[model samples]
Target: MENSIGIHISQSALFNWLIIFFISIFGIRDVLPQETTIKTDSHAVVSVKASLLPKGLLGPIDISPAVIPHDQYPIEPQSPMYPSFPSTYDPILTGRCQLNFSNMASIIDKTASDCSAPLASLVGNVICCPQVNSLVHILQGTYGKNSGSLVLQQAAAEDCFSDIMSILASRGANDTIPGICSIDSAPLTGGSCPVQDVETFEKTVNTSLLLDSCSTVDPLKECCRPICQPAIMEAAVRLSQRESSPLDNAKIPGKSVGVDVLSDCKGIVYSWLSQKLSLDDANAAFRMLSSCKVNKVCPLQFKDPSTVIKDCRDPPSANSSCCNSLDIYISDVQKQMLITNRQAINCAMFFGSLLQKGGVVTNVYDLCNIDLKDFSLQAYRQQGCLLRSLPADVLYDNYTGYSFTCDLSDNIGAPWPSSSSLSSLSLCAPEMSLPALPVSQNSRASGGSRGLGLALTLVLSSLSYTQRAIP
Candidate 1:
């Protein structure tokens, strides 16, 4: 009987303690200030110029101070802006990926800016085009002064351009712009335009030639110059990988001549072509280009004492066919067009726009094997139409032909073939549910935590009163 009585008293004490604990916690919550819980279930945008929390727990996060300003550049109030290349749009000459060019260019531009810092402060990562000039200067200061063979010089230039292009292409896609095969048709679209007919390239090469020219320049050079000049220098870096030329019988001993860079240039550039050039096409081109080496066919090959083989004299001149062949090899069959598509999407998305608006079409479905239904095609078409209205010179400069531009942008507004509508798309992944937070009541009302604390305190006080009343 005595043990039972003691057990009952102990249970009573424990119960009272529990009640008091709950009330104290609630009371503490009531005394605390209310807090707002921001639930980011939807897309939440934070601007670069936005003010931060007084406690400094939250703020507009700047990832690369070298590129983006913390409190400077106003978050573009409307949308991201894409790079506007002043030129005529050409499909065949620029590789049917006009959209990629515009979009990728924009992304590169933005990311570059993001990585920069105030001049008064130490400069950070130089990412965008404006900073690319500095990057070039830095690189030149490091390597260009050497008396290395021209092949090395060219390779160095090419590498730099490819790096920049790759960076731009990677960062351009977003919620506004579609992903691969979303902005345009897939590579298969290139197959729609026969590859066997190099006539387009032949014409472009002929047009680019300045009568009896020893070489041909990119047709889009006029428009792409603003963009391509940097790209070309970067691409020229492939020259650095060249092998020293074989010694000629009459030339000075222990001296270097020209260099060939690629181990399999001829094979990748010529033998591996298919119906539609895939992304691998760029890889192949780069492989051949980076492996450029000295051609042994010297005097017969064009005997300039400099074995660089970049130029040929009239007597041993390369036939115009060489330009035609090269054009077909570089522009016609290589996967540069596919890359352009990827780039365009990246650029357009950076600015909350579409390629069709800029008068360029990427054939996302045909080129990237993406289904139309997987994305918002109607939205993209609307954006494309807007892009089409931009300055014509940007189009002409970037694309070599007006026909190419029209084919990409104007046709976007045309009624979609029933087969290609978004409804027919089957590649979309299922959307996931987002988390939600409790809705806030009156701003002046106690928050969840504070209310809980107050209730806890009140419960403790009540429990104490009840204990005294019960005993």
Candidate 2:
């Protein structure tokens, strides 16, 4: 029984050992492929995703593949991936886009109210209020356009207000006239305004000298009104102050100088009008001055000399014959002047000894009558007045009474006249006295003489010509 029990135990133990061996073999087969995949994936993740690692963790990590050498892979400097921020203070980005007109009007109104109140007691309520109101109207008219910055417009308005205030302060301190605001006041009489004061003020402000100077040279005519008007007003205020009486203690005139009644308050009215004239109006006034004739109602006098130029440009009346005769005389003078100025320097040098000496006036018109027989082409050429080859074609139209062709082809082999001497040449034949050269075949035989004659004619002409003033 003992032997049989031992055999059973031995068989059971062998079966248990066989079961353990098979379990071990299958477990290793399943785990081996998974472990290999994990190792391969971890190596690839480290190589490709290394930049994602934390800063401290990256030092211990070796991300490069074992098979690839570390030196083969170059480390490139990394640049930032986002754009840089823009400046906040840039004008294009920060400048205001819109303007508030109502707010601007309010500012102007406040400025006018402040300046006008103090001025009212001095110049009277009518004159002072209108001045400030006019300024407000001007500001609205000037900057009420669609475009322009509010900042710049405000600045311009402020400058205008400052100017107005300055004018008011000056007047308030100087104005001592009581009832001197009345238009009916008499000039030089105590508290009386000058009747001709308007006319005088107009004459002074629109002086012919000032008008002529401004028209030709003053580019600031558009802005001159503001500066000039105030000056005239101040002058009028002085006139009133001079005329004001200390004995008469009359109250301030309730009846202010009305627009239509300016003839009575001429000084003040003209002063105001001087500043408000448009460019067109100023030009018209200047034109009127210029159009004044010597013997006409508005003669060219000390007050208006511009009419002298006007008579030159256009006569006042369409039927006026004064300028027509004047124009002919002027043309003759200009032609003579041109002839004198154009004489060749070499020509002047050649004939300098032959010219009349002393203070006697030389008449260039007489130069047209010089005898060609006395001059020679050889002498002219020696003075640098001739060219070897023709430089340009001479137009027959430019030479009066000479219809023959004057170009290079017409006179080959002949030395051409220098362009610099053409003006001298014109003087030589001023009356076109040279007989027309023959256009037929026979003309070629005399071509040499004609060419020589032309040269001689020009030289003699220049020698004979002298400077003379036109009457």
Candidate 3:
């Protein structure tokens, strides 16, 4: 296969790069983040729209829709960051499905971007798989709008599932969504959930409380306040028994039985709500729930940093060697993948503790003045993406392939441990207590997203976008 590569950099950033280039040509030192205010307040923050476009993730380009005009799509002239697509390009679709793909077009576009070819394997566990599962529930609701069925039957499920994969493949989306997520048509068939019908579920559980708690979800406070999750758990527990079964009246597991049974019941509960609520609301609520889970932990796997510790064993009073090593190490970390703000904290704490154990007595973060954004993919550490700790989703436009929001907090330092840190600290605990590090800016903002304005978010799987993609 031949490689078809293109980059779409924002016009403003390209102009800035040119300015830096010219300054260097005149022999004047280029001013950088070293001149910005080094102090950080994670509390006072705003989101910057950042797009981590998967440059080569979709594999060899498929120019299926033959000849078309490109200028029909109206967007600010982006030089070379996102790959441009035809605004009017149409995909070959299956006509047998009950749900009109036209109405669900935006989400279908997002699915393609989230589950793109190369990205599926890298971020399948955290981003890709979870999104696919959410999409399924939403699709179920949309499909049964007129019919009022919560779950699809065996034959209908097979046809609709085929239609979905077909549409995604026709676009540049990855075809391996099922295998990558370890899912099957089983979810569409209601899987192990005993209560497949809406009537049984509504009658068995307290539908009123469930609807009140989850009809509207707050992405920011839901995880901490936890109104919906507790309600869902309560409903699922009750449904797990359901008094009796339609199959054989067999007694299923009780509330305190195996976790697997309860989990199945939770799926049923979601399906029940999907029928009761509108499609958009279901999508939003499901994505927000996913956001809560993904933002909780560090998704990147850290390698042994024997070399970074060795090079930074002592601070040099004369040369820039130690700081040089520190910068190089951080740059390498930033190239791994896009990370959430909360994950950045865990990553920072982990590397700091490692250095301490390795005999690097001094705090390298202080010495170098490395900001929290330094640990994420960035252009020279200042123009970086520290993903917000809220419900973030991959976006798709007629022009830009996929984009997301990132908090552009200025020069937030990575918090060094006062002593040793236990890995079991729960910053998200309801008490909001920080028994590890002393209370400060780090404690308050560590588990929270950037306050206020939202601009969309994407945790990009890989950082090979700027590099040329060849196969």
Which one wins on TM-score? 3
Better of 1 and 2 by TM-score: 1
Candidate closest to the true structure, highest lDDT: 3
Ranked by TM-score, top first: 3, 1, 2
The local distance difference test score of model 1 is 0.25
lDDT of 3 at 150: 67
Candidate 1 local Cα displacement, residue 470, angstroms: 72
Q: Pick the winner on lDDT between candidates 2 and 3.
A: 3
Which portions of model 3 miss their true places by more than 4 Å?
1-83, 86-103, 110-130, 144-149, 153-158, 171-176, 179-183, 243-259, 312-326, 356-361, 380-382, 395-402, 420-431, 434-471
Model 3: lDDT of residue 9: 44
Q: How do the residues 101-140 of candidate 1 rate in per-residue lDDT, one tens digit apiece?
A: 3423433343333222111011111112213322222222
Better of 1 and 2 by lDDT: 2
Residue-by-residue lDDT tens digits, candidate 2, 1-471:
999999999999999999999999998876653322224644653233434446786367565543443332337632222111111121121123232334344333333332332222322222223233333333332332333211123344444434433333342211222222222112111113432233444443444433333333222232222333334344445444433333222312433332223222433433233234443343333222222211011100112213323342332333344345333332232222111111222223223212222111232112221111112112222221221111111111212311111111222121123324333432212254322322323235655434333431121212222224432
Off by over 4 Å in 1: 1-142, 146-382, 385-471
User: What local distance difference test score does each model get?
Assistant: 0.25, 0.30, 0.66
